[model samples]
Target: MATSRLLRTSAAFLAATALLISGCSSGSSSPDDEASPGLTTEAGAQRPAEEATLAPLPASTPAGLRSYYDQKLTWHACGNGFQCATMKAPLDYSRPEAGDIKLAVARRKATGPGSRLGSLLVNPGGPGGSAIDYLEQYAPQPASIRARYDMAAMDPRGVDHSQPIECLSNKQMDRYTETDQTPDSPAEVNKLTTAFRDFAKGCASRSGKLLSHVSTVEAARDMDMLRAVLGDKKLNFVAASYGTFLGATYAGLYPSRVGRMVLDGAMNPELDSRTTNIEQTAGFDTAFTAFAKDCIKRKNCPLGTKSTQDAGEQLSALFKKLDAHPAATGEDRKLTESLAGTGVIAALYDQRAWPLLRDYLAQAKAGNGRGLLAFSDSYYERSPNGSYSNQMYANPAVNCLDLPPAFTSPEQVRAALPSFRKASPVFGENFAWAALNCAYWPVKPTGTAHRIEAKGAAPILVVGTTRDPATPYIWAKALASQLSSATLLTYDGDGHTAYGRGSTCIDNTINAYLLDGTVPPKHKVCK
Candidate 1:
């Protein structure tokens, strides 16, 4: 299975449960006028030179707030023994009273033998991945753990049933995901640039006004509302990958309401888009090197090289070959450069997937492209029947909303390529281009690359896996250092997220914290 599936499927499962709840009104300022300190508008327009002042929490939050929160929900029974609902929130937080936008929420009450600890909100990264789906599918907490908490998830604004931001039709998505992320020449580069522009245009046309407000900050605030509605005095959360950023933002904004939060596969909110993309590219390179090292020791390694560098060169050559002459899958699909690259990226997320990747590479080299294409399809979440979850579309929408575009244009990307490549010789160029997805985003960012000094927050735990591919390990370090009261938990492993991907030490440490409100000592490492 692809690593994306591991994360995306879990995310989708969480989103599935959090089915439509409510909407929030846009604040007084237009989306473009919102104070985003370190980001530029979609048109590359600079934000007005004014500092953003944090709005004070509502004075003496209404005594009937919980009742109001419940009354706003429209509930329905969903699959997997859960209830789903939709609720309204402002598209812009600045004008909470002006209008309302809908958000999807779901919950499965714990069937427990332990005292209820309150609602435990879960988010599985992607900035766009469905939190409801993760809760429904992958939340394998012990019945003892489940018995003590009501598990809940919400599809962030502009995702899934929460007034979804659709950028393209299914067919267009197929074409878009297949567009080469890595360009080998001027022609290929132009094709890549055009693909990105077309994607942005598609989003603008399809999503219209909705695209302007699907940001992390907005989602974080929505989470606070969810917390209020659930009648929990504090927010307890398990967030992976980009979800970590969301969770961290919540802690920053509502530290007094934090119960127990676990940020797995954390992203550094302090990094600029360029730095983030470059660092992630390097992370993939590190992961690939780990894979290559392991591959060389195995007798059946397809690349059949003694050195990791040689293995990368061979894989690059294979990609070049695939680009020039796409391989036909028996099912009438062809393996293009993008598909091959996707396959490679998918495998890098988990060490267990390495053997599968090797086998697929071997089969592809023999002119049977089915295996590799299957891996790519899995990463894209494209089922054989041609249906796809809204992950890719959601990923870009939320990601673009969270930070400034990595580059303003192809020229800027080209100028930065050498530095990116120097950071990760094998994967940098491709990731540098992939970061362009936000360059033409329909919504302007309302947040920026600033250290989230979550001052006044209770002790928050930040988790990191040394070999995590999607979120580099250093991010956990950076996030912990930035947060005023963060404690870092390290898991020396190879995977996307550490808590549940199977590390007894990691799981136990986190579970103990969640259960007792105890933070691991700073710089705690779990082997």
Candidate 2:
């Protein structure tokens, strides 16, 4: 599983749950704005200067790619001050003449009393997450920054609107996600592997040729093209979770064009797929331990108010029970151990969902699976009507193409079980199995683990939550160290990413960077 799933799924789960529960749902460089540095104004006023400016292609650009760089975008108003447009990119960069594909783009112009600082591209991980969806529904950029930059996003190719990869039908996906990740018997193992193979075959049958070309390297190239089409001399971006990899790839590819980037919940490009999954398993363990500590402090904690070890054992016990007899949700769906684990893992992404986790756990312990099932559904991007977004399809399409599979066969996973279980007693086995999906991918791997050193890039801020469940904090430290110019900002807190989830120190420091080109001091730490 791509670690980028941390931010998008968890945040979407939070928003969806809030609707189920409550049913609800920048710019000023003036003396007044100066007095209140964070205040923002309406962007309704027209700024003719915001019109598109095509950036010049680099002198070394290949002749075949010149047209892409020179293409002009005609944006049309979508809704709520947002503009929508489409961009054309090569289906296969090596064979540009073969075909072209369209990428969906969205922009919300700067609301400003200050001169525009160009576009600020945003992406919220997922390898499969919709950048446009994030830009419209979730980005929490401060007013000061929004006032000076037109917030923009491009759904990476093979993602949401970018000619997404289609895999299994909704009914098939339901079975795939619930397929046992922890196989006790050979028959169970065969079932699991068969599901994975089916998923891979489904993608090959539907998405076909597109699968081979959706690698991160290609996505980064697409982003640079996006920057040129937006007329920005340098690309200014804020990417989280899997998006960090995309941003880092961009930096590695176009170091000279790096501008004001913030990679929150950053990923380390140096690790192989197995190591990534193992480390992510450890991350979830860390997050769950933290949750256990918090849970014990609360009165109705379902795992019992004893030690965290005991809590882990209790949760493990519950999972075992469900493995034998799946808990029935209100609907036809049952909460199997796989879905239950997904639910628990989803809640671990955000501390704000701890109470909900507690409630879900309580309900699950009592045989009601609805709560946890809801979380699993959100993680899978499964709608109430039983349709799934293409996230699962795109996620593996990108991950498998980017790196070799963690395990080539079931025997390999069984061999690694010891290390994985040591890293995460509760989640290790399942994660180890989850990593096996790519082994059955129709396309061979095109990328290998390596360090990314954006040699001449401007100082990039990388934020890491000390207890992030998806992209571990260690990745942030590693990425910051790898980048030629990077500053590590540590949030000694919980949750996936740090920028807009709530931390004045973290937010203020990032706001300064995005607004006034202020770089935070080295080794900055926020509580």
Candidate 3:
């Protein structure tokens, strides 16, 4: 969940876990068309049975899946020092021989004398975040796990380096995001509706068939294929934000395949889009409150006086000011209220960005919006050359397809405005309207908010930061409660996620589990 729009961007309150496995067997036309792959029975051996009940084992893979499970990957030199390879999976699982999609995978080999634990797949949230970039940056997957496990990363089906989803043209996207999210006039509302309709049309035109197939459940199935191609008997994974939902789907669909999974900044799979957005609205409000409390203490704090309430009012007023008169960046870009809000939301993702946000707001108040515009630009993944990646485009595409829209129409959104306002006074109206983007989507939702009881799965660690803005903290609690074999690990701190940000307790706890079989107690809380 890349918060601001990325959380709302990807999470969109869709909770997009509408993954349906149907029978235990693959979705192939004929269950007996081919023999099932030899999946391991080891996950049940050491899995914790703390929950009242467990989900049944997934049916064995069909014979047609043999090529996918038995293919050998040829790793080669890629960017920097990491090894890279291409793995192939069927575009439609129901028709295995119809077509295929290429997946880009990158890995840093285990540098250790300790026994190799196998490949540890990692995802840095963003249903759209480039796992390749994350792995290349080496921001996640700490050294301990790296020492004994091959740190592997894969770009999901409709993400970077894979068969990515592309929507509006660069110019159209700029227009789309700049549309008044908190529309006041009827004309503005219609313009907003057009923006969404046109954007969805662009995706339908550009993405075509891929648009209908990139569900989180399908992505999870891709992961199982990746695991088999990598020659691993069990899946060892580290997923954050939306990735958590993907992992949960995997475990629920293939419980016997889960091995040493960690879901950081978990997303609750059981919550619907509106409920998810409402809760996330409150989550951001909470994070902003924390930031406001800290900001008022600093010298030259920009959001007016010391009270969080007063600070919120000041920020709200500033949004109104920008809504009327957008600020100019050094370039042609203007800081529309939407862009400014994105800037503010981007900074809220990491506590380390607050001081900079304060400075940006101060400059913005002084008629200089370069810094804040830069923040928004980064959030939008817009390049200075007026080019852009498919991140922002794919984020909503995955989100909209995974789960139904939070609000189906402008009327519905208008009706729910009060509830949204109550949830997040500063961001409610805009987010409420932003939630309407999916209403005009070209593709029907493939998933829904459902329980992910990954019964018989190995001990999975679920991490939650108390003040995580993107994926609400309570989401972790809810997810842990839903997963029959999950262990809840709480971090009472600031930031979107809690692992590998210099917290020894959190890192050690996760590392110990990845290294050995030491799951933390149910209520383990770390500072």
- All candidates in order of TM-score, best leading: 2, 3, 1
Give the runs in model 1 whose Cα sits over 4 Å from its true position.
1-75
Give per-residue lDDT, candidate 1, residue 282. Answer: 69
Q: Write the residue-wise lDDT of candidate 3 on 1-527 in tens digits.
A: 12225642222111111212111111112111111111111111111223233244346778878889888999998966699999999999889999999999999889887889999998877778788877776345566777899989999988989989998788877877777788889998898888888888889999999998888888889999899888899999988788888888899989998899999999977666776777778778888998999998877889866699999999999888999999988877788888888889877877767777899999999878888877777777777787777887778888888878987788998988888888888988877888888888888997776778876789999998878888877778778888889998887777787776656778888889989979987677777
Give lDDT for model 1: 0.73
For each candidate in the order shown, give its overall lDDT on alpha carbons: 0.73, 0.83, 0.78
Cα error, candidate 1, residue 182 (Å): 2.6
lDDT of 2: 0.83
lDDT of 1 by residue, 345-446 (tens): 876766667777898898888777887787677676677788777677777777777678888888998888787777677776777787776777767876
How many clashes does each candidate structure show, in the order listed? 43, 1, 8
Weakest 10 consecutive residues, lDDT, candidate 2? 32-41
Error of 2 at 381 (Å): 1.0
What lDDT does candidate 3 reach at residue 15? Answer: 18
Task: Work out candidate 2's RMSD over C-alphas.
Answer: 9.9
* Candidate No. with top TM-score: 2
